[model samples]
Target: MTVDPRAALDRLIASLEAHYNAVAGRQSEDDPAVDDAYDILADAFEVYDEALGTAHGEALPFYLAEEDDDEDDEDDEWGPEGDDSYGDGADVEDLAGEARSS
Candidate 1:
């Protein structure tokens, strides 16, 4: 069944409000309400994005970062214990300079 994009957008806006309220009223650092609201917000965004794309061939300006299962591979690429592959004191400017030279 196709979802109505307008309704989906309303749901997404409501979810955003709920998430903001959850964060504002959070009781502690590890508040479950905030986490629950965040999950709901993510779901609502996905639903709205999909409905909008399907209905109007349009999409939101931003997207949620998807969780990946290849975390171990990422860790390996960064070296043991998540150490960066870059040498000590390396920065973006240095990388940009090297790229320009090459």
Candidate 2:
């Protein structure tokens, strides 16, 4: 099922407006209305991005950040002893030695 990019863009704009309204009229710090609006806005944005890419071979300049991972876990990939695995098979230590000798 293909979506019209223009329509998706309109929906995305409306969702943004709704989110702004929800935040502006917040009842409390933990307002469910704001949360719901944010969710809707996120969904609309994803749909619009997909539709725009599919229809015009172009994409938005930015992307929504994923919320799945814990902030502290970001550096786990580097590990306690940082291993440089440059996919091109360049030895980082050898490069550093060459730079120092130069």
Candidate 3:
């Protein structure tokens, strides 16, 4: 049977998000697969909203930084936070730079 790619994508994303939140937020149990999902979601969000150059909102004119180095302290970090808050502080740009530097 044929399937809608976007719909399938959405379902996959939802599953990942659910599992990721369950483990990361609740800390009920650690699953390696879900850990992988969390990692994948981090990049997916960036590409979907940020990389696409979409505006955050029409009313306010807010935007996501084009470069990770340009990330602000107030903005949530892109990758995993130690305490498991995905929105915690960590500069995505700085993180990217560190990755390249390595």
Candidate 2, residues 1-102, lDDT tens digits: the string is 899999999999999999999999999999999999999999999999999999998999999977846534535443324455343444578668879999
Error (Å) of candidate 3 at residue 90 is 21
Better of 2 and 3 by TM-score: 2
C-alpha positional error of residue 51 in candidate 1 after TM-score superposition, expressed in Å: 0.4
The digit string of per-residue lDDT tens for model 3 on 1-102 reads 343445545755776677667576654366676677766665554444442343332122443445456444334444333232346444556667779999
Clashing pairs in 1: none
The runs of at least 3 residues in candidate 2 whose Cα sits more than 4 Å from the true structure, single-residue gaps closed, are 71-102
Q: What is the TM-score of each candidate against the true structure?
A: 0.69, 0.69, 0.30
By how many angstroms RMSD does model 2 differ from the true structure?
Answer: 8.2
Worst 10 residues of 1 by lDDT: 74-83
Whole-model lDDT per candidate: 0.85, 0.85, 0.52
